[model samples]
Target: MARPKLPISATILVKNAQDTLQECLDSLQEFDEIILLDNGSSDDTLTIAREFNAIYGNLVIHTSEFIGFGALKNLAVSYARNDWILSIDSDEVLESTTLVRLKELFGTLDSKDLDSKTSESSALDSKNPKTPQTPTPPPNTLYALPRKNLYNGEWIKACGWYPDFVTRVFHKDYTRFNDNIVHESIMLPKDARLVRLDSGLKHYAYDNITHLLQKLQTYSSLWAEQNTHKSASPLKAIVRGGWSFVRNYFFKKGFLYGYKGFVISVCNALGVFFKYMKLYEATLPKKPRSCSLIITTYNQKERLALVLDSVRELAVLPTEVLIADDGSTEDTKALVESYARDFPCKLGHIWHEDRGFRLSAIRNAAIREAKGEYIIIIDGDMILHPFFVADHLAFATPKVFLQGSRVIVDSHTSESMLQARSEENAYKRVFTLGGLKARRCKILSHLVYATSRVDSKFFAQKDFIKGIRGCNMSFFKADCEAINGFNESFIGWGREDSEFVARFLFNGGALRRLKFAGIAYHIYHPENTRDMLESNHQIYLETIHTKAKFCRYGLKDL
Candidate 1:
């Protein structure tokens, strides 16, 4: 049979890798096309890539600033002309035999048949593409090759480094890397299959102890920064470091490599030790935080104006006010601008195109634009009490999210209160609500205190979550980033707030309920159609089932 014409694209990302660039390029000569994404290379890296491009017309070079490894790789994959992607590292050289095997595998397997087997039955019609969707990988096939690492000038095969299986070959439509700054890995569907190649790639990971130590510091810092929500202590770091050394040196049989094994083991322990130490350092006390009040609104200009007016009467004003407008009209913009003329604090309005209910996305945008270290989120319809800001600030605890209840105003009372521009009328309408708890909370707002509660369990109880309204909540920006803000995939209202609170708890954030402090009166409005509620509730249940802290399509993905 004739050799298959496999249209595979070899993708590589580099930064100042002049030394190993040529060898890595030479190893990938069999590939139909090679994509090189340069990350601001200062050395001869670009020169080498240009030379390769001249020699082999298959080379395509693109330059960009250094993003994280996962994001950079995803970008490079997007540029590939072919469906099959062969991801190669700058310091790794592919084996010639592996290339031959890959060609043989592709020759025997029909791509269309594989797609039919792997894809969902209701896969998108390629002929009629509407919205952008993530591509599904072809059935039962991603290629995993063993990687051999080189330490200094020697191949340290026995130091728990040999046969390092890495999945590098995949259909671009089905796989993408996670967006982690360091130690990023590809995420595959739950049922994807893996095929192992006989030949392996050579990884020139480190030149000497100096280079290894340098990388240890860099990777440790990235890991610590990524895990800001995780608590780290000195004793825990010491235990983890010692355990790592023991596990790698003894259990994994690293001692067979002699001095190399010992050095590798020690380095491994040190890396773990430093990672936790840096995490501990991050938890140290810092400067006083500035607060930003994020008010979410959707086309309710008059109600929003009332909320802003309430802000003007605050006992303690926030550093700034961020309006998370969910596709509101120009009139809402004008209203915010009108308030900005003499608002007590700086004012910002973040508005996206109206696309139904995108409350999560707008909130994320507002959070990103907010300059304050702490954020207080509320709805535009919820007119706040005078002491709301002061109360939130007083109870603001590190790594704890504050959830406050709202007093619902009936339609009759809301109309009367809106007609009358007095704060006293708003309070009177709020007190007339049927529930004694609401009346009591509103009457003794200053006397009642907040109660701290940590839900260590994964699942959110309905009664507990019912009180955790997004209309009145506050949290540290760092904690919000840790759980990746909110799941933007949540369309329409419903469980978005509860799901976020569940994730906040899942990521080690304490939950505190403000009984009387941070009180707000929820003005009556016609209920939005609950058509999407069941679907959104199912999504929340799934989140609880998976105990998901960070959503795949969250703030970072934006």
Candidate 2:
């Protein structure tokens, strides 16, 4: 049999998408041709696309009339020459795997499937001769692509941002966009067989707060205009405006999206509020819901006890305290158990075995067990500054995952730990006579391969606190689960936290270094993790440069 030709072309609808157009085009280079519809660009958008043609194998550009968003898209798609078409916006980029998969789907395109219709069975004709209408699937026609949107520079892994169902690739004859004035939904045939693509669209829709507000204003203005012309009443607009904010921000988990997401929800609310407020200035009223609190934790017995006491003493009690613990052998378990039994408010603890030092694993394990609608994670060793949890909860919304911070203990305390910890180079908790903090850097690295004895000062200065610590961090339960939880392979005391945070932020998880919002005090302890740190450090040195889908059993082998 002859190899099937890849029947795919990509179409992009653009209007001043200059700053982000090249990255978009680069992602779709595999397609046979690119039809760019520029409404009217004062920028180098067209010039850049033309320039890309030199490097990209095949590309075609078409300028469209600035009629409207949907009309412009429709006009652009009308010019595509290929049987199958892929559409993307200027702010999005395709993952490599997604591109390969799309091509594979194209090569196997079945023309006959798109043309087939369902046969009516004679047996059912007696009762209801008039057959019910069943929409046909978009055979070779429609591909439901995943769009991962990033707001305020953070990839929103949750809050309905990532894996958004967008109809990107399609057969030219069947798919067409509707001609709505604002916030228009896509129009497709009833029988469209939508195949979801594994690849994701990295969308930087709003780079910051200013951009987000601007877009909201445009959308709201357009919406009001459309509704005003549709015989909308003042009361209806008011109700819808209030409901929209409540629905998206509180009900849909927008609060979990962090500051950017919270802003988006607020903008969404404003869009609804303003649209109605403009439509019926005197009649409309908007009411916002109060915020909910969430908490996260792991193995610190004394510290956990302190947090529990502080929470009980709070003026405004949290909706709940979510204590997430990795398996703890010391009083940590007892602390959590006691909180669950004696605490006045709703208290819960998620417990897992003391596996290796997989912070992500522990975090994920705990998050799954969270009961609060919104969630926040904190370390056990740190003491919260009363309003710490309240501050994050205050900013809660479905679209936001608040990132909190931790300030180290007083200089004197740190100085004391530094001095006391620098006494031995290879300090192991098991061998160090019940101490929890170890002061041995040479015991773990090849730098001490020759010398069994370790210098405390050198070890403390070199290895004690270089990477990002998980002592203070918070996000939505839904968002964390969406990213498949944190990477579980970084099972060591060093660099793992930084590595996971980098992934979370890069994948569009918004962050806010709570700096002054949540203050925490680090407790003193004899080093308990010397052996595990040494082992994990060696693995980090060996494969630190390697970024794989699954980090090959870093410390699991031992």
lDDT at 240, model 2: 77
Q: Which ten residues in a row have the lowest lDDT in candidate 2?
A: 425-434
Give candidate 1's error at residue 343 in angstroms: 37
Output the TM-score of candidate 1: 0.49
Worst 10 residues of 1 by lDDT: 125-134
Number of the top lDDT candidate: 1
Q: Which runs in model 2 stand beyond 4 Å of their true positions?
A: 1-6, 108-140, 228-235, 277-558
Tens digit of per-residue lDDT, candidate 2, span 1-558: 543434666778877888899889888766677888877888888889889998864777777666767777777778878766667777888765565455444444334322331232111213223322223233444656667787766777554565586877666676677786766545777776555545557888888878877887787666666665444456766677677767767777777876666777666667767777565643232211322233344455644565566566565565667666667675776666777786767776666777656566666665565565555666665555556666555445343334444544544454443444434421111122212222222233222222322222322234322425666655555555554555566565655554444434434454344443444455544444655665555544433344222343321222
372 in model 2: Cα distance from truth in Å?
63
Name the top TM-score candidate: 1
Compared with the true structure, the alpha-carbon lDDT of candidate 1 equals 0.81
- The pairs that clash in candidate 1 are 137-174
Q: What lDDT does candidate 2 reach at residue 132?
A: 24
